[model samples]
Target chain A: MNPKIAAYLRDHAPATPCLVLDVDRVEQNYRRLMAAMPLARVYYAVKANPAAPILDRLTALGSSFDAASWEEIEACLAAGARPADISFGNTVKKVSAIKAAHAAGVTMYAFDSEPELKKLAQHAPGARVYCRILVENKGAEWPLSRKFGCEMGMAKALMVKAAEWGLDPYGISFHVGSQQTQTGAYQAAIARVAMLFTDLRQAGVNLRMVNLGGGYPVRYRAEVPEIDAFGDAIMGAMAEHFGNALPEMVIEPGRFMVGDAGVVSSEVVLVSRKGEDDPVRWVYLDIGRFGGLAETEGEAIRYAFRTPHDGGAEGPVTIAGPTCDSTDTLYEKSNYRLPLALDCGDRVELIATGAYVTTYASQAFNGFKPLAEHYI
Target chain B: MNPKIAAYLRDHAPATPCLVLDVDRVEQNYRRLMAAMPLARVYYAVKANPAAPILDRLTALGSSFDAASWEEIEACLAAGARPADISFGNTVKKVSAIKAAHAAGVTMYAFDSEPELKKLAQHAPGARVYCRILVENKGAEWPLSRKFGCEMGMAKALMVKAAEWGLDPYGISFHVGSQQTQTGAYQAAIARVAMLFTDLRQAGVNLRMVNLGGGYPVRYRAEVPEIDAFGDAIMGAMAEHFGNALPEMVIEPGRFMVGDAGVVSSEVVLVSRKGEDDPVRWVYLDIGRFGGLAETEGEAIRYAFRTPHDGGAEGPVTIAGPTCDSTDTLYEKSNYRLPLALDCGDRVELIATGAYVTTYASQAFNGFKPLAEHYI
Candidate 1:
């Protein structure tokens, strides 16, 4: 357990199925990412965990934000972030959202398709807009390369059209994927973006920024390469591609920023077997997929667990949530083993669960309360 | 469109991404189910969509509730359902929830394992308990046989122990699975339960009330066997196996009760191609997997759509929600097609979305508001 979270749990004993995040650790992560990529501007992906404390801390640390919608942009603005510092990063934007962001003085926007770009051009005229290009999602545990971005051919046309449509052809962006393990994924995507920059520049678009959208991996059950590795690989690729005339580099780090900084403390609701001789015990916890562990779908993003009786005799377990819905089962195929001594009411901490857990929680699914958050 | 919902939509012009559900349709569905299987009592599964309006309407219709948690029990009670009319149906429940439900005068419970049975025995002393035995989920779109239910042998032992543990070993229960199409699945499950009842009776333990847990299917994009078919098959199997000394029949229906009674009204946020010659258009809606369409995880529940120009020429489409996350993409492999005339801001209705859509919505994921709900 994180010492701060452990201390908080021991001292205060907050309710189970709540997230206890260390805001100071978030600061440390911000500083680490900044140190690793000094040339790149940090835009904390607010959708990861947009708690007031984390947003306030990041804003105070002089970090910009990659807002997914108008509400997120407003959240950043409410946290004292300048509108110019917040990018409306989602490619698909509601016209109302575009108008809201524009009315709020938010300038930067992302789009892949003509319709979305048109919405941006009409509503947020003269807004700095970036085209998100499609890139492969090879090594991401939770891939995001499918739905948002447009093809390179389409991106090429969109950039040139942006200027004609009364929007700033500010830059290009591509998310390699989320929880990306291989540094090569970034290298390849950067290469692709560099090609788009060259094509757009030749067409007189002159894109000036490169948004290396969030894909930085954080350690979970398995070891991931250090943040320095991603930073090194990305910078090297940018250097090779841009050759000192690098555009303004912006990094959206959602999971990397907050994932490892928080822990989900859950109580074991039940632990029993299918049959008397069944080898694997079904371990039910207070938290599950709908309770903000949505990333556990397909057993991707496997999370490390901490039981009260860790380091004791272990047995195979299929972990599930405390819901009548069977889909709430978390880890069934994954070879999760827990202490055999673990029983009902025993608290367990799901480690590195800051990002993507809170907001994704169902609003009282099965009438269980949404996951609670306590940022220290 | 359901005429009532269509009329409501025409009159109210409610915001996009709202669920317009007709409570009269719910009453009609309940009446239809009761007419089909008058021998069985209807226990509306509260987890499906526990909106107060639906619960209130069901309560007024004299429908019993199958609550998944303490909060759901409270919801049922607040909707005027008597405590005795509510069954704590979740197999894995917290002790606190058990105590709460028991204190609220809820006597009926469901359990799958010894640990859960013990929790019920200790917390809800003398509570009428049923053991959920696992059965095959061959044709279920949303299968529940895996995460819940125990082996038949274990359920047998647990029920015998429930008596010793100071609980009413009232019955045997099993879910064929959610959205169960083949009535034969229920027949098979009934036969299995009947054998268990005979064995228990021979062992001097008479078990009454076989709870045929929820799995009744409702129309989505495809046709399903009518509720009458399932009712007839189940009753036939019960008579054949139980030899007219029938156990009290109980059925829980989540989706069938309200799935077809609701429709989700969304707007096209964007409609564009990935590339110049890309054969498929990516239709981005204001709602996606995170916005209550979570059952679209594997393209399982394919919802029929109604666009303004639904009868117009259609093209293949990959549908997604308006989130930065790629996983929010709802239909990719499902070969879903939409009207070619669809454009940004056009209203579209996702049909038969009443059951599992509302509560499954994320709490402002990507800062998009939760799917709005209106019960008329």
Candidate 2:
């Protein structure tokens, strides 16, 4: 734990199982993304963690938002997001949400199918819509063209139907997938979507928006894509492909925008030796699967742990949450050592969990409520 | 989907994500277990799905509860669990919770350390306590002996300390681990804890309770252990080894009691083609990682999805939640075919999710809330 974080925690009310945001880190990250990708419009994906304060900060900085559901739309509205600036990027939406978006006067929504078009026609007829396309990522490792968009062959047909229905399609969009490690995946998607744009123009469909759905990877581990290099490659591709004729480029960056800026601090409840041969150490903390830090099933995401005062040392430990489930392990193998052999009542901070952190945390275990947010 | 379940969902307010209990299946499962080990007292682990209605049904069937936290304790209490009938089995606990349990007059609070003993003494002085031993699974595929327990070497020392402190140390307890598929593992754990009890007796610590922690497997797929056979093997061991001298035997069955009783119904939002390889079908429903149905890393648990209505003839389709994260796939491969080539606005049920299903789920992503629950 950082001394500054520990001090802030002490000053604030002690709330375990809460999310803590480092405002400075978030601001710097926001500025860094803007500086690196000066040409593209950064639409902060609010589905990651749309806490009011965080949303307000990002929106105040001129960051547009990509909302998936009506709840996210309401959150943006509550956070004072200009209705026009909110993009309902979630393609498969409820009629109620579509009606709500229309009622709220938010214009842009992502549309992928003909049935969706019928729903939009009944609900938000005049909504500014983007034709979501499934651009095959020939260069990527895990292609996400599985859902969310129409394939290249269906794209023009879908667009033609939109034209036939008197629905004015505004642009084209493609999502490379979340947690994309390869920068080239974005380039591959862009190259394909760009070609689709030209094809749509030839097919007599005029478009203005080119939304590259957000999958800009946050540095979850040190091995993830470098933001600057990734930014440069993507920007260079956009400039080279569309030049000044590029439609308004929108990217929904969720985890990339805030993952590293937030940390979850919790108190240790029990310390026990797990087994004989391994001499496994168990540090049961208040945060479990319900905490923002519960990503342990497949390829457990390793989180960094440290004490407020370095006391000069640490050791190998397997951290488990307070839940009795066997799968409640936070870290299967830890990299850093604790300042001392950590005991119950000691506090620990899980770092780099700002995005997708608390948004998906459960509140079932301890009566510990969400944490208090203190801006740095 | 099951017409009854579908009608139940349609009739009820759609605000709740329910854990559907098949009473016939549950009662049949209970009968099978009882038939296998008629002499053993089966304690359903309430932490799996602590909804009061579900607990009421389990209680009506004459099953005790294995509670891990104060919340579980409260649930058990609300369901009319007597203090002597309940055991607070979490190796770790909060002092306030300990005080609450003592006040509630629940006596079998399991403790793993002298520190916890001291805390219990201060909070619930002379509380009837059970010592938790961290026993090793000599040979098992999925070992859980790695997380929480006092080592065999320290077990005697902690027991001695408890006796000296005038705390009534009742007996020994060991958790084989959750989702245990191996039947021999329980036998090994019982033997170990029984020996630990004998050693404690020799060291002048007389005790009665011998708790074998819950890990009885539920049939997720074909590979899971047969519940009746598993119960028979464990109870038979106790009856043969300890005979009339066997202490009050306690077994906590979490997933076993409620796993197959529940089903999650979700509406398919969109189905599209992936690429030249296959048609990419995505059924976007209202469930997310908040539900235990979304396995740890968004990988759907094996056998997590089962349709209520046998779409008589079926086609391969991927069922996924509506979360924007690419990892939010519910099933990588379809187990069976759909009744028809499905389109938008279709609801399907992910069957056999009663255990660890939720009224509690991650509240991340659009203020994600749990669906309304029902008792049918």
Candidate 3:
């Protein structure tokens, strides 16, 4: 555990299974991103955390927001962000939500379907809109398959339709999936966007911006390249594709910005061996898949776990949540190991959980309280 | 859609994507269970659905509750249940939660480990305790692994420890997994319990109660044997094993008691094909995995869906929740077919969802509101 986090936990003695976010680390991560991609505008994805303190800090730092719903827009606005800085980033939106977003003075939007384009036309007339192009998200930990984007043919048709409907076909946006690891994924997606941009321009639609949507990976259990490497590769791709006449570039990073900034302090509820001959020990924690760590879905994204014992003898153990539900088990497939000395009341700090943890926690499964979040 | 649910939605016109519960249906299900298992006391599992109206109706019917947490015990009490009627069903519990339950006069508790038995002995002295024994939970749709229950040796030791700790070793309990289909699963579990009981009796431990833990299945897509068949099989097992004498029988039914009683009416947000030639259409619903239908985990529990256009030329479609996450896609492996005429704003009634839907909803992921439950 970070000494600061340990000290804070000791001082406050907040309830176990609570999230502790370090604002100083968040600001540092933001600065790191800014330093890496000096020319790219950063639109922090609000769905990652959306905690008021995180939003306020980012807003104070003059960061824009990539909002998926009207509530997100309202949250960003409430955090003192300008309306123009918020983009309705979700392609599939309710019509009423679209109208509400327009009423809230948000002009930018994203769509991948004709029906969604028509909704935008009816609700937010002449709004700046982007068409997301589907790309092969190969190396992303969370591979997004045919969920948000459309093909080149559909994109071209949507752009033409937007122009005909008096909506500003302003840009192209695409996500290379969440916790995207490969730098080549961005380069390849940018190339596809470049082709689409050329096709749109030939069709009398000159797009103004290219949104490199959030997918930047954070260091969890695996090592990842720094933000500067991604920036270098992306800039090289932009130079190769768009030349000197590049449009305004925007990078909406969610996990990369805040994932490492937060630590979840959970308590060990039980440690029991299944049988006398069984080698695997089951270590149950106060929190589980439903309690904000849903990203451990399929045990694909393994967060670094820190027990109170730093260098104690380690043993392989299966981790589970405190809930009665069997599906709430977290690390059955992954070979997770922890200190053998870990016992009940011992704190386990789940590192790099700032993004997608608290936001995805079930309200109350089995009457277990949703994770309480604390900001330091 | 069930005609009653359709009428309720039409009459009330609740906001899109809400859970509409039929109190009459719930009472009917309860009555059916009682008619089947006349000797078994019914203790409704509150984790299934803790909605106020459901709790109130169950409490009014004099139904006992299987509470997993202190909050659930409080909810049962607030709903007018007697403290003695509530059982602390969860084996893994916080020490503070045990103290709270004890203070609230709840004595019946379940534990599967020595640590938990010790905690109960310290906090809930002289409590009526039951040791959960590990059973081969086969033929169940949602098969629970070793997250709960202890092996035979461990369970025997735990029971002995419970008696030594001055706790009442009242009985034995076992869950045959959720959505259990085969009647033999119960018989097998009961036979195992009988053997354990015989062994314990020889050791001078006189246990009184036998908890046939919640596993009773409900018809989702496939037809399950009626509650009567399960009751007959269980009674047959009891007669075969115990001969003349029988203990106080208890059945904690969660899904079977309330599953068919509720209907979740979710709106179609969008229906779009990935490509022109792509035959599979993607139907986006306002509610998804995070919106309370999480039992769709691994697509294990397939709830029947009724679209507005029921018989209008059905086509295979992949259903997804209205979120940016790719894992929110509900049916990709499962062959889910919907009407081709289904459009945006069309309502789809998810049948047999009363038990696990509302309580599992994530608290506002991507700014989507949880399924608002309405009871009629």
Give the best candidate by lDDT.
Answer: 1
**Models sorted by DockQ, best on top:** 1, 3, 2
When sorted by TM-score, best at the front, the candidate numbers are 1, 3, 2
Candidate 1 at residue A32, lDDT?
97
Docking class of 2: acceptable
Compute each candidate's TM-score over C-alphas: 0.99, 0.87, 0.98
Report model 1's TM-score to 2 decimal places. Answer: 0.99
Per-residue CA lDDT of model 1 for A163-226, tens digit only, reads 9998999998998899999999999989999998888878988989999999899999899999
Query: Top DockQ: which candidate number?
Result: 1
How do the residues A1-376 of candidate 3 rate in per-residue lDDT, one tens digit apiece? 5567767888997888899888888899899999989889999999999989999999999899999888888899999999999999999899889999899889999999888898899989999999988988889998888887888888988898899999999999998988888999999999999998899889998988999998999999989988889999999999999999899999999998889888898888888777766778889999999888998888878999987796999888999998889988999878888888888778788988889989788888988778999988
Error of 2 at A215 (Å): 3.9
Candidate 3, superposed: residue stretches over 4 Å from native:
A1-3, B1-3
lDDT (tens digit, per residue) of candidate 2 on A1-376? 4355557777984567566777666678888887878777888888887878888888778888999888888999898889999998887787778888999988888877767877777788777788787765543333464667776867777777777776778888888766677788788878888887888889988778788777666554446767787788888888888888877878788877877777777788876553334444566788776555645444345556555545765666667777665566766654534554577777777777787777667656433344445556
Give model 1's docking category. Answer: high
Cα RMSD for candidates in order: 1.0, 4.0, 1.5
